[model samples]
Target: MATLILAQKATSLAYGPLVYAHYLQDHESDLTVTVEWQDVPEITVGGDKTNVVLRIGDIQVVGAANAVHELAIMSGHASQYTDVADQLPHWLDFTRNELASGDFKQLGQTFETLNRHLTLRSFLAGYTPTEADFAVWGALRANKIFGGNMKSGGAKLGPHLVRWFTYLNGLPCVAEALKGHQRAVESTRNRVDQGNFDIPLKDGALGKVVTRFPPEPSGYLHIGHAKAALLNQYFAQKYDGQLILRFDDTNPSKEKMEFEQSIVEDLRLLGVAADRTTHTSDYFDQLYQYALQLIEDGLAYVDDTDNATMREERGAGIASRRRDETVAENQRRFEEMTRGTDYGLTCCLRAKMSVDNPNKAMRDPVVYRCNVKDPHHIHGYKWKVYPTYDFACPVVDSLEGVTHALRTNEYRDRNPQYEWFFDALKIRPVHIWDFSRLNFVYTLLSKRKLQQLVDEGLVNGWDDPRFPTVRGIRRRGLTIEALKQYILMQGASQNILLLEWDKLWALNKKVIDPVAPRHTAITEQNLCVVNVLDCPALPEARDVPKHKKNPAVGIKKLYTSNTLCLEAEDAAELAVDEEITLMDWGNMIVKRVQRDPATNIVTQVDLALHLDGDVKKTKKKLTWLSMLTPAEEPGLVQCMLVDYDHLLTKKKLEEGDQWQDYVNPVTEFKTRALGDSNLHDLRQGDIIQLERRGYYICDRPSTTESPMVYLIRVPDGKAKSTAAKVNAPPNA
Candidate 1:
């Protein structure tokens, strides 16, 4: 049980702890908290405010989710809570310290601070709403004006902020805590009245949760794209809904049929099934009509403003010269654009929503633009103009009867402009749910930069093992189950993060370790031959389990003979007469030492079988392949092994840094190896473990020109030497 006492006048400051405490209480956790309001004092000692103090069985906490978080940690859900320091930079202090300064202009700057932070996040502190969220929303709820605006949805206060604000305010504890604050309830009255935006269901009607996964087929799908695709599938299945695969191929300049086909194939590999497939270009005529109607209603106009001048005017909030163009002029210019005329190519249709609008997205934004450069993949030269995402998304979503629209919050700002189309077109509005886009450290997912790499030959191609594209990583040996698990774990987290590749591959290792077939691959350079003095005169074959844990995988023959080969590194580690276990063949004592002194390379070794010695007692267990073949033995498979390092040296690419400067000079490593004969039958894309080495993917089976098999290195949660080391002599 806990006791919470806050200044009655500053109950708003107590929002987080009070709400969190109430939440645990309602969950029937062995948790009870009694909250009482008191008078706030001007001075707080040691930064502990008496107005918002919590006593959890004698442990006193001052602010944030301190009490609740400590309890969560104790309950074994440590990752569920985050540090309160992160919440300090939020709107809570802005409204208290800055807004209270009586400078109304400060609100804009405050919103900007919170807005930038929210650009890729749904919560204030972490993936889930922390105590910081509850506190901020609570304080905002107390300010009758902000609270009232927060509930209305798409508040000018900040769309991202409002999105999070409404969601948090709707939680059971939040709803219960704000009971006395009528404005908050009334403002958010529309939220519940309409329905939960997160889980949209038709009102007084029956229908599946129809959703869509829209991708602009400009480039191959990368690792970051998997989250969006997987989440859509997850929600659709959870609700027994239909997921539509829609190609937002509005930009003909970049769209291609090849890319479109590759996207479909990629999703198939990821195991994403769609109930229906669609192309935005299919609704070209409808979008054109919507644009005409908007122009006819004086809600849009044709702008001849050049790109540079238009950007300058927009930044300065100055109206474009054509803002007041006649509807006839707009219609004519629009027709000319459709015909691919010179005048049409220079002009674009812009929404006449506002010139001095506070929200920049609503400030007469571009709706239709001429794209006479490249033909649409599906429509050829039939249409010369294309509708921007801002205009096409809402219109198509409504026409297709989409119940929910899930997208990256990077587009959060343009949301108002999106819904405005539906309202103006008098169509049903689809619920918008934005999740943060995925990003990785030392990697760029931008298609333009990726294309630059291809053009400059910085990497092999789209499927370069170093690239993050689905094909690239698959080539690098990422299993489907691993990709699925990674996506599911990060589902709907609005926090935009630049994560390390370590955790991702760490999860991948868990999926592969138990089932991966174990095989042996010895390095070719400086390969050492061993003379087994007491070896069998006549070669004999013994079968060994492919995977020790699961014998059901079957077995392979371990050929034995008087002659054998061992890796130079293993041979170098042996001391004359030192006993070592020749794995699967009992112990052997090294008798003779052979080396090329100039390079310190071991040439050969003479070993006498130590059958009586305890195999466990040996320090090193070396894997050796017999050189003499059995009667029906097929020779070991020759293969090329490939590995990679981060393409960029910089951890995070900043705006000022030239990316080329950070390009890692050496990022790929290759070595020749001899694999077990079983590798000869394995097809491309098979993943296997090389004992004492690393996991590898078969990039190419033995072919006509390249008689040797090709394998790519797979990260198995182990640190590896850099690409530069591959150039050095073996074991240097």
Candidate 2:
């Protein structure tokens, strides 16, 4: 082991090596790098302005361009620094030459390049955080300080770039560098300290870390929405910050008070309480005023560009003729849009960002749309024009004093556009954190597609057990604890993978399997009647624990009688004169078997109660139901057991695939069964498990038209097999 020396400034010039040094220092407990240091020379012998230089024994390197590059190459090869040393070179050249240019246009292009690179990644160069990220991020940070245009956060920076930049800056070491060691003085602006469980922030918000989870109340929330909610909840709790549940209900065409109220109920059911529930509708007047300010400042104009042609022009990088509309003319047309007249519907307010930017999102996107079909969910028909999500989100987030905005990476393209609004409105800028969108394979989580299933009568409704909505999964017997555990386990990762459903259901089993009460039900069709020749004349009832492994869960009753019932399938397997064990009862010997004359289906069986025989000797242990006559108290109840298959045939549906062609031919199946008397007391929405069958949720309790309890089969871990035609293979 030999000494390695670093002689560099803590300034932006040496920020690349500085960030990497900080990362190396953070992981010092896990690493072994002998090091030494020296002060920076007054001036470089060479013309290079780079601040960092390193020396390891015989090897010497100068400037960040060479020092950072050689640090990666030689450290891994000869000095044994870290594996990241090898890959840092690839990113250094790009950062030093391309990213460090400090040119506004090059910065935009650089942001676009970085945005595409970080689409589904957490780091710049590898699966784990590496020096490459620090090198590149350092250059970006330096640009932010020296480059005034970048500091203002215009439409030039892409969303993913901003997201990654924000995430890196949140790192403990990076944060220390950002805020400096000022004990008595601090900038009025906040440092963006928000991210995963591992990302550390100082003393929680108290009241400083204000955050919000904005949901558009157009449909019921699905599992994907749960991810967004839970992540926001995680950070809010992590920093002791306030989480506001703001309904982004700006579109009058889709939003309804019914949806608004349902969303409230759903969030409550999820066990997440917002510090306060607010709505984008709350800021309609303020947003309207902001729009006027944009026009008056020549940053926005009214465009009558047809929908199709506007898209074509955007793709072609062609400017709209309305781009040059005078401020007076634009405001006049905007006033018409607010009136909801025929011409108003055709006119839209567009931002004046760019018409030929390579990024299509910056190509003068629409800011407002006109509609007056129905009263707003909160405002009623008092106003006609509505701000687009792009315009409202950034504006309201800043207006509400939101310190950090958690956005799904799906909005990565329009990030620059969002910042443009924040700048044009001249409000406090909120930090943007983009996490990957949640996606599950073989499941449809889209509210729009789910709505189609409801409208087309393909599914029961939004709360149908087969659907992936929160209400649907709960209806299917998934516990809220299990749902939360499953989602949070995914962590704050940025990787977007199509997850399998088993992982989620498996978590549910951990929660429900322990506490869910146990009951009994025998198939109604082809039930076998057995005669216990030497049993007590009268039926005997005894109390039995619901869960054998968890006795504290309480108990249910079991009855034994001379005549009992068994599943026809179980009886068919029994041989005449062969002794078998009746679960909960002693061994019984099969004396005779009776069958239908034509079909040969087991119809009846005669057995002798051999109480002395060892139950362990029997290979066949059966779940039997004692015959309860119509005269028995709290009598047996007939019930329907239902199970379902995936809605789509493919494991992962591609964008080009037709939904109609992939719809499962048969998704639901039902069977009739006779449940124990105790089951009669079970009500709808109760989760229980049958002795020989699987877990179930009581979908419907006894009613005049439907007397039997309806038990919807809830999946354990494996996919259930159905006898009906299935698009997926058996057991899928």
Candidate 3:
């Protein structure tokens, strides 16, 4: 267990660390912390004494900031404390230098800055709280002047600050920390409960609740499958129960070992570890016996109705001709099916639940089908007849001791049929809970459609950036953390919603923005060369932070020379003597412009350094790369920046609409660009930002075989103009 030593009469500066430690102990099961009070004297304002000390085994940390950092690291939650890793030290310094000042005017100014920062964001660093919040909140709570101001309506402290403070203060951990070893007070604030994420199961018991994720091993797991798997894992962990990963591999013609392996790998990537893995085929013999029992009990019959007529009969609420077949004859046909006889190849076993039930799903649903051609991937021709998902699911779930069957609402109509099997077999029944299916507008979640796209070469493969598979989105720059957080936020809402892609990508932006390294790339097409008249004769190089707000992301070498390259679009908008800011560099004035007289394309321009000019006053902020100097030429790295559009043009397809008719004619787009020298060091999968452009992931690095580096654009969940666009051809 981790131990935290604090002064008996701790000061406000130590409360943040105390609260953070308590939070870890409560939320992180692996980390157990015991706080020990000591008789150490409280440090004065300018004293050089540590108020908080944390010890984990042999690791010891002194001071409030270090203690929080140590606890976060020990609990495997350092990311929460370092979301703004680059600027954390600067913010920590602000808490010490400004907020700790005795002057009331200086303290007010500090609060004003913090209030404005919180205006558009919930936390100081990222979407979630960081060490900056912990330190700042502690400093503010310690100040008597700030406390008095908040008590007196907080008019002078600013409303945003007050709102943020109240929210943080109400948290259970924070409340407990303030009470100093006392029990936490229950929150009384009324919040708009959008939907309950923590869904409680009927008769759910700790260590006994069991859940299962049954995926058909026909294709790669898509985002929809991801939601189901995650929810099952979430419930299982919530109840301290076992989670089973079961593959519904009854359809051998479509299922494959490769797909099953991929599903396992994807689940592992999503942080879902099943307690046990099994296949529906593992109980084939048992299922066959169950079917025989149903036939003997006259609960099921053999039907030879053709595919078209069977659908027509079910739709018209008409009984099949074989509905009254004798039990002995049905038993003979089922035995023939198991033996792969040609006569039984055309027959299927159906449950005789209803002839004209209001619910069409109960109208003699097919329970067993004959497949004599393709050998089972696992069983390998051991049996010719296979039980349908409807017959196999409930039996296997009960056999595996699953207590709750969490499934998508699309199966809600068949819930009764599922329970019917349990009653017909006189076995244990599993509770059924239906949550809405995850559907994205303009996206296809059907495995058959996705496979068609691959077979026709419409996409690279399952991992194509345009596809919605788990691997596809990850390649497209969607972090696993962002995906999990987004899904959990949706929870188990019963109301089905056709969600837009922007909301998910927007959540991803919050995760990657703070850490993605920054670089510069100028479009190679119609590029204009600019001569900086006042530039130094020789090239100058300086090391600058890759991410402005995050110094911990490290630095990149930026070079400046007399000649620079600029995108023609920015040049065309410039007027004679117009002032513009050159991104990382200082402001410059456009002195001259030269264009191709025939096409009006920008060809060449002249600029003069205006370092003293106010960058805020400049209307245009452009990205430029230095080309050459009097000493030597440092050529820019060549890159192919690729972007994509939705696979389908339509936002939402209707029931009868042919999806192929709505397929986007030009979903893939490419643009040639010249990037900064720093891009040359980028390896595959490195996510970086091209200044004035959006984020991108390195798909391929420059090699002897392929000279140009390949970078795929990452969506920023912004308007079309701000993200990657399809202004050029596929190979441009």
The best candidate in terms of lDDT: 3
Candidate 1 — what's its lDDT? 0.77
lDDT of 1 at 726: 29
RMSD of 1: 18.0
Quote the positional error of residue 472 for candidate 3 in Å. Answer: 1.1
lDDT by residue (tens digit), candidate 1, 1-732:
667665545534556666766766676466566765543442163765544677667677765445445544443344455455555445455535654433446665665666677879988767776545655665555555565555565456777877777787789887776563344445444432332224443441334677899889999999878878887877777777778899999998888888889999999999999999998988999999999999899899988889999998998899998888788988888899888898889999998878877888888889999987788888888888899988888888888877888888988988888888877889998888888887887788888888898889989999898899998888898987888777766657677888777666877898888877888888998889999998876778888998899887668877778888899889989899899998778898899989888987889899998889998889999888877776677778898998787778787898899888888777777798888777777789888888898788889998658679888888976545322232334321
lDDT by residue for model 2 (110-176), tens: 7788889888887876566665777787677667633454576734666677777778777787665
TM-score of 2: 0.71
Q: Judged by lDDT against the true structure, how good is candidate 2?
A: 0.77
What is the Å distance of residue 289 in model 1 from its true position? Answer: 0.5
Candidate 3: C-alpha lDDT: 0.86
lDDT of each: 0.77, 0.77, 0.86
lDDT score for residue 138 of model 1: 54
Report the candidate with higher TM-score, 2 versus 3: 3
- Model 3 per-residue lDDT at 104: 83
Clashing pairs in 2: 72-85
Ranking by TM-score: 3, 1, 2
